[model samples]
Target: MTAGRTLFVTWYDSNHRSIIPVGRLVHHGGAEGDLFEFRYIQGALEAMERGFQPFIAFPDLCKVYRSSSLFPFFANRVMPTTRPDYLAYLEVLGLDPTEADSVDILARSGGRRETDRIEVVPAPVKDETGGYTTRFLLRGVRYIPGAEDRIARLRFGERLFWMLDAQNESNPSAVALRSADKCLLGYIPDYLVTDIAKLLEHHVSMNVFAEKVNLPPAPLHHRVLCRLEARWPDGFLPFQGEQFQPVGPLTAPPTHADHALQ
Candidate 1:
């Protein structure tokens, strides 16, 4: 039963502290273009909330984590506070040299706690169908200056990665965030591309609740995702099939729906 779980690992630092509390960040995106990784972790947390045991791995800094014991909640199981080398930790897990993906890692422990640590969770979303009964709380809003195309699609397992910027006119100032259920998704990527239409049929963009309460604006990185999705071509698709699927509502309001206009 423990054969098919996924363990999501993320690395963080001072920048993450600016967006949200270091503790709540376990489920939120951290600095270093790791939002995609956090998306995987969010799936795990949702699993835990649904009575499933989920395992998440994060670095335990002496300055941050007070307890020598990493395991906090029954749902949130922490790995041993070893050093942060990827290959070395793989060895510590006693895994084979050929194992590259965390999906291959078996749950080492027995019982419930063991199973929770390895299973993969799906992203919480309300598809166009509006079928599922669950409603996940909206966390932080992120603005990616360059990821419009990519974030707009919001498909099954898509991930966004970037750094934090506090000086934007939208968010007043960089403040330490503490809410456990929500976080504003933000990241600064190393690369940006503009001409996404060369590779894809449709443009991508998101309608986020702006400071004006109900107004949803196309986020900053909407351009970035569009460009990356366009240039990379085959790299973005997890499966080799039809692409350009809309991840959110089919018809957004006129003002918020147009990323290409802005």
Candidate 2:
């Protein structure tokens, strides 16, 4: 795994189509294993007003706390210990099941509706050119007929807009993809939500467009392809496109066998 990966706490209000960044978790690598430091962000002021306190046991909001273990706020994302447990967790996120790591789960659930209002999302990982690309199958085609014809007419790289679909009955975090005329194209995949949501929340410049559109006789969800490229502005701090390092090596808590020995 890469190093320097940062995780953030974000609050998504589906009613207002808003994402508020509340806090950040940075991994300080060392031999103590999985150590992390937590701090709140300015965007979290609203949450603070609403009585949501920091996860660490601290009285000062400006103070930073480090733990050689996972904090309770983030431990929920890493608690599943079995396949069934993992699947159940994924179901809560409205994601299809597969073998996935904590990072994958975090990325997918960052945009999850059924989970808590605040979620943990990994910061965008940029490529060598200080940019990153995201590819996803378009969602919500069933709601719009004639989408096939409309998609067929779209040219590659045609600009698209990502907006929060506040009125979506199915998922609150449903991000709608729109054309220049504001026609609904589809949605960003569940997995891509965390990164894209954070980018939008922070007012980052992103170039989004239709990458590919499959012909009919195929599933509607898979018919339209979309992509988002980060156009990092000069001196954009969040655009830290660097290798991610793990906080520390993780060791499973003692199991029944270990208890028996003890």
Candidate 3:
């Protein structure tokens, strides 16, 4: 990933039982200095109509927030290097502290906590190979009966397949991950459900496997890591739907504004 990367910020509306891509936090690197900015998107507007309130730190949805470093709200989510087990923390996420930046770490670990319903996801970038790859630590593990036991048997690099659960009341597009023996583990992250389904529908060549598995003592979200890669279909852009579009600029002139990222 480049220094100039954007991470999508999502808020879960528990009442609506939906996840909204409300804003984007962008990092821009330049010869002079690095800059970071956060701005609400059109989805925020819709979310507000659905009873969502702007976060206290970002009270005005229209005002663009610029900072020389990651905002405290997000920066706090990253593990501090001072911690003795900081490297071990990254290890559980299958990341090297030397290689993963705050943005990279947040993207993979999701920056999710019991405190709030916020999540940060890295946008999938196309590679020179005309393909793209991304990893998502599986969610809803505890909810699935026997999932914890099944995950214990998951071997690194073991193949996994997507199984659709159309009858699911919460999300009809819900897809579950399973082993060859059909040990139902968990569902895909809500954010990637639609995009993954589209990929499967087109019959794209995909490689899905167990990237890592950390047992108890690890948070539920970090329990299972999955790596998925697929050949890039022509003109494919993940999360390009209307909801993901920005209503405000990703990086403005350090002033109030409403413009989209280039």
Top TM-score hit:
3
Judging by lDDT against the true structure, name the best candidate: 3
> TM-scores, in order shown?
0.19, 0.52, 0.90
What's the count of clashing pairs in each model shown? Answer: 34, 8, 0
Ranked candidates (TM-score, high to low): 3, 2, 1
State residue 236's C-alpha deviation in candidate 2, in Å.
Answer: 2.7
Error of 1 at 235 (Å): 4.8
Per-residue alpha-carbon lDDT of model 1 for 144-236, expressed as tens digits? 332233234344223333223457444333221211223334332211111122222333332222111111242232212110121233333
Q: Where does model 1 exceed 4 Å of error?
A: 1-7, 15-137, 140-202, 207-235, 238-262
- Candidate 1, poorest ten consecutive residues by summed lDDT: 189-198
lDDT string for model 2 (1-262, tens) is 1154577666765565455566667654434344456666665666566555655443455655566555655656563646666665554433456665454566544533354676666665566787766545677677776666677788877888878777776667677877887677777754355555666666777778777666665457556666678865455444232212222333443222222110
Model 3 spans with C-alpha error above 4 angstroms: 1-3, 248-262
Give candidate 2 regions above 4 Å deviation: 1-3, 13-17, 30-32, 50-60, 79-81, 85-100, 111-115, 134-176, 179-227, 231-233, 239-262
